[model samples]
Target: MAKHLIVGGAGFIGGNLARELVGRGSKPRIFTRASSSLVNLVDILGSLDIVYGDFLDDVALRRAVKGIDTVFHLISTTFPGTQMESSVYDIFSNLLPTIRLVEICLASGVKKIVYASSGGTIYGEPKTIPITEEHPLRPKSAYGQSKLTIENYLNFYARSTELDINVLRISNPFGFGQKLLGTQGIIAVAMGCAYYNRVLKIYGQGETVRDYLYISDVVDALIRASERSGSSIVNISSGFGHSVMEVVEAVEKISGKMIQKEFVPARHGDVKVNILSNKLAKEIYDWTTKVDFQEGLRMTWEYLINKRT
Candidate 1:
């Protein structure tokens, strides 16, 4: 088994990745902040080596990367909807720390890095349906721009150094362990509202479309990316698009309860529609999403209902 270190191991995706690693008989080290919540990793506390610190700490980053064969970079300080208000902060905090991380990985002799990127926002509004890996990157939000910046840096290091990098431009992932209160993760937020009998908020006429994938499928893609050799970028998505209103209907259908909703004016960084083609992911990792949208909705609703009661 290969040893691994996760940069944002306490987060939704990172926590799931850590659990998956433990299930595979790999003991993984997770670097998280003191203020970060560990609710997502509560059950598997004994299975992981946890380190507490911020990603900007050079010494902690160096220590965490030592002796690790691969590093899973999943830290993101901003979201597409709110990044525009504090663009400079996103650049200084997220982009700079990631550059430093790449430098540390290069110096510490880490073999490879698997990056979790944004497929939902990276391509902006698609000029064509089913966006491919070769789609032009015209990101609208600062968060998307920052992710693109890191990708460019990874490409640079791959060309100049001996490091191998894999960028998985993952689509919208929602399932168990996601925060229900946050602005991100639409499905989780909808489930929260439905459970509490609150109004589910939808922006811009509820017509914005997104490609959703489950958390377990994303972890599988990450593991595949870690095992696969060579430097490349691929899209890990469902290749099926669902509108915002459609998601609400799915939740209503699954729970057998009506979901009360409200439509507000669209935000600045919001896109009209975004979907990714998994052709490259299939060719590279022989991977395709196993969970359909309806099944994923049922699973998420059940998890949310169980958690609430």
Candidate 2:
């Protein structure tokens, strides 16, 4: 019960996390799907102990948690927009595995579990400018609903069992390892479309605002949560808001080229504005973003540009 395991350590956040931990002289174990690509982990792949398995496979899940203390659960098989495609995919794929994971962790004598929750979709429409952790839990989309459900389960397990848990309601994170053309991750998608000379689509005149945090800061928070002594729920965010139009302008400024835009009607279940308050995270964990917005954008832009070469 003294080892660290990253359940979904193949993706953008997870890969970066593994690298950071390795740099800090910690040899972390990574649990990812057999199908997940290792592009983001190419540099640090040799430094990790990777175990491949499906989330629903009890045997595999149990094996992953065997002799491990803190589990960083970061797996999401479905995106926010595509969660509605299947009636039960979110429940079966995302939510159920979490509950089962807790059961397995308890059985294996694992100490703590740090879950990656969503800040963008969890609190649907904010009644205030900067939403706090105390805001009512009302998610508008299937993805958000699924995250909240997992949070509830974690709370129940924390209270009923000896297992410790921490839920990180992370804001929209954009950086080097994110999906370049994915449906989610506005900054990643925009950068991808811009590099490939594809038209960037704007929903509802680019009015939606979201809290965007850098990936390094996000990894820092995840590491902090793993070492945190208390079982609690906190928001990991930049505590600032950025609109779609503002993002577009920033990209244009960085790339020095105007991105071709096509404005479309707003999609369903989209939040109008979301700005998370990181005051709790600061107070609780003494965490804050060291990378500013413009610097983060510049780094992302450089990564995207170098990607084409």
Candidate 3:
């Protein structure tokens, strides 16, 4: 059994991964910011070895990686929409620290590290309907560029130092425990707005496409990536594509509330379509998404409703 260290164990995917680890009897160590909310982690706090620190702290990062066999790189300080406005902040705060962390992981003698990359933005626009891992990387957003940069560095380290690094280019993931107030997460945010009867803004015609995977499916992919012997990048996603308008309709149908909408100009760097093919993930990890779109939306809506009330 590998000694686990999760870099951002308090966020949506990170928290779910940590919970799954604890359920399997692995006492994982987690590094999180002191200001990060503990709402998602409350159930499993007793089982985790918590380290409160920022990634920019070199000493804290070194301490977090010490004696750990595998590292899960899941923290992100910037999202695609807002990253361009703060490019320098993204580079100094996110990119530089990640480079340093990789160096530390190598020095710490870590066995392998799994990087949670973004399939949603990394490919920019899709040339084919369901994008495979072989698709050309033309990330339009600063956030996607940063992720690709880290991925390239990981490849370099893996080849040069024989460090094992795996990348999961995951699509948009949504389910319970997701933060609704964030700039991203259309599903969760829509549900929250409907619950309180707030106006939900739609960009362009609201026809931009995305492949939405459930959170548990993503957690499974993370675990499988950690267990694999060889290093590889795979798309962890639902093979189906849905439009933003479709998501709005789904939320309204499930919640029995009309989601007020205002059309806004589409944001720059927003991709026209992003649908990932899970063929590689299935062939490698024998993984498939078990949750249907409507069912997953219903589950997420109920959780958001209950939490709101």
Candidate 4:
């Protein structure tokens, strides 16, 4: 049984990855902050080992990396509804911890490390549609900037130390186990609001396009990336674009309920259209997204409804 260490394993994506590992009969350890919500991880609480430690704490990180063969670095502090001016807070809280974690992983002799990068924000306002990995990274927000900074560090580590590192530039991943408050998953938030009879709000004209891949597809990409060699950086996306309004309409159709939507001015750093091309991912990892958008929406809505009862 391979031992894997997942940082920020309590969060939505991390938690789903951990569960996938467990289902595959591997030993997975979850490293989370002391105050992180456990709602997403409650079902697997008994099967996994939970270690509470701040990312900035070197000693704690050292302990977390011990005896782990693969390290999945998925922790980040930036979220929606956070004040943009407090970018410094996110850097100090997230970037520093990642640096320390890399140091620990190198010292501990970990075989491989996989990083979850932001495909949406990292490229900022894309000069080219269907952005590829080579697109110039011109991040408009501090969150995007921070993600890019970490990706640079990972590239340096791979080149300088010749370490086995893979960076998955993941697009918007939405599905089960998503939190209602975060801007990470628009579909999840919309479904939550619909379930609770709250009005859904759209920024701009709701024509903004994004590549929304389901959580299961993301997990498949990560697993394949972990085992594959060469091409350290690749995009994990659905290669299909959907408008914000389309997502809202899909959610309403799935839930069999009318969702009230309110539109407002676009927020700062919001990209008009951000969709990634998965050709490289398909060629390199031999993987392609199988979940159709409607199917994923149905699955996510079902999961949310089951969890509520």
Off by over 4 Å in 4: 80-84
lDDT per residue for candidate 2 within 1-309, as digits (tens), equals 258899999988888888999999888899998998998788787889899999999999988899898999999887666546663988898888889999999999999999999988899999986999999989888888888888999999999988889999999998988887777888888887777778988899898999899999999999898888869999999989999999989988888878889998887878899999999999988899999899999999998778767
Name the 10 consecutive residues with the lowest summed lDDT in model 1: 78-87
Error of 3 at 44 (Å): 1.6
Question: Higher-TM-score candidate among 3 and 4?
Answer: 3
For model 4, how does the per-residue alpha-carbon lDDT over 10-81 read when each residue is reduced to its tens digit? Answer: 988898998898889876899999999888777778888888898888888888889988888888877643
lDDT by residue (tens digit), candidate 3, 233-307: 999999999999999999999999999998999988899999999999999989899888888998888777677
Please give, for residues 173-237, the per-residue lDDT of candidate 1 as tens digits. Answer: 99988988888988888888877788888998889999999998999999999999899999999
* lDDT on C-alpha atoms for all candidate structures: 0.89, 0.89, 0.90, 0.86
Provide the lowest-lDDT 10-residue window in model 3: 300-309
Candidate 4 lDDT (Cα, 0 to 1): 0.86
What's the alpha carbon RMSD for model 2? 1.3
